[model samples]
Target: MTYISRAAKILSSRVSADVVILGPTVIGEGTIVEPMVVIGHPVRAKLMKALGSDLGIDEYMDSISSGSQIGSNCIIRSGTVIYEDVVLGDNVETGHNVLIREGTRIGSGTRVGSGVIIDGETIIGSNVSIQSMVYIPRGTVIEDGVFLGPNVVITNDKYPPSRRLDGVRIRRGAVIGANSTLIAGIEIGENAVVAAGSVVTKDVPPNKVVMGVPARPVYDVDVFIRKRAEYEGSKAP
Candidate 1:
């Protein structure tokens, strides 16, 4: 059942009938929201529950929900849930079953693949490509033009179940390979590359290529680029 709030502003002609848009959510022009998508879902429900508020669910949600903003020309696939207070810039696309929590900001032209879970307070820059099954924890910062391959896991807690959470920062144009696990508090420098299945435990210098369980710099970005060019040139048309 579709539920669009009276205070919501939906300028898009492509929103599916089965979607639920609550609060003052804004869906911009030409955006396509697929079936089962829930935009501007209030996150205050958890807080209200914890506080044992006497207010009804709908009433409390309506009172505190600020709603999300989905920019123009974007595509939000099926089963995606964007919580209230999230902002998606123009042309941002998300694959099926993606979860973007509150306080997350996704810049324009970013493409998030299926099963991606972006926890609250994450900042993702423009043109970022996050492939399938990526797990981005809270406070993670991904700069422009970054590529996160399938099943890449970025953590936040340095010590398991600890109070302190430190997010990993992936600088501009960095490439994190498939199945790579980036430990908390590490920084992948600009244009750096983490080879497939690596477990990064520390900072990677700019333009370097790191690999292995405790990933170490093996070569520079120039070498990796040259090798890629050679491989592409060798392929038959």
Candidate 2:
């Protein structure tokens, strides 16, 4: 009972009833799309140019990509809105009510939790886990094995209505705790840990742990991991 657009190419995918797929999209094998999912929805380029041109926010004009591609073994939950020009690798899972904008590239084994809003032009690598209510702005780059806890807000714009907006870069294996806010143009280095409720305004070095407002270096990441392991072991029955 799937309603696929005549222009779309589905390759042995599973789409639930009430799902709409428009434009030129390609779905790979073993992909499961739940009900109320919108794929390859059309965007009004004229509207963007009309309103954004006056504000110097013309960067969103090229946000739409050429085609939409979902790889094998991907699970797109209900109420998910995925725009055109996005590519997803195998074994990706999305929770309900997720909004994924255009020009996003997601690698294999990525799990996105419910109510997550990922803006356009985002590049996410393999084995990343983004928890619920996380807001990832456009132009963000998340490397492999990054873990983002719930309510983590990653901003892209340095100033409102400015054309010089840039997103944050999160390196491989970094862990961002819940309710952390990351400002634009900052880099979280590999294996770094940002503690909960931290407001990160500057770059974080590799293998370090940062906490507090305008988060500063607290300790080594390796030490924190070791301590966590010890605590978990102590709690074992």
Which lDDT values do the candidates have, in the order given? 0.93, 0.87
lDDT per residue for candidate 2 within 7-99, as digits (tens), equals 678885477767877666888888999999888754557434546354322222223324488889899999898888888899999999999
**Candidate number achieving the greatest lDDT relative to the actual structure:** 1
Give the true-structure RMSD of model 1.
2.0
Worst 10 residues of 2 by lDDT: 56-65
Error of 2 at 71 (Å): 0.3
Clashing pairs in 2: none
Q: What residue pairs clash in candidate 1, if any at all?
A: none
Off by over 4 Å in 1: 44-60
Error of 1 at 139 (Å): 0.7
TM-score of each: 0.94, 0.89
Could you say which candidate leads in TM-score?
Answer: 1
**1-237 in candidate 1: lDDT tens per residue?**
577777889999999989888789999999999999988877755555635767765556655678899999999999999999999999999999999999999999999999999998999999999999999999999999999999999999989999999999999999999999999999999999999999999999999999999999999999999998999889687
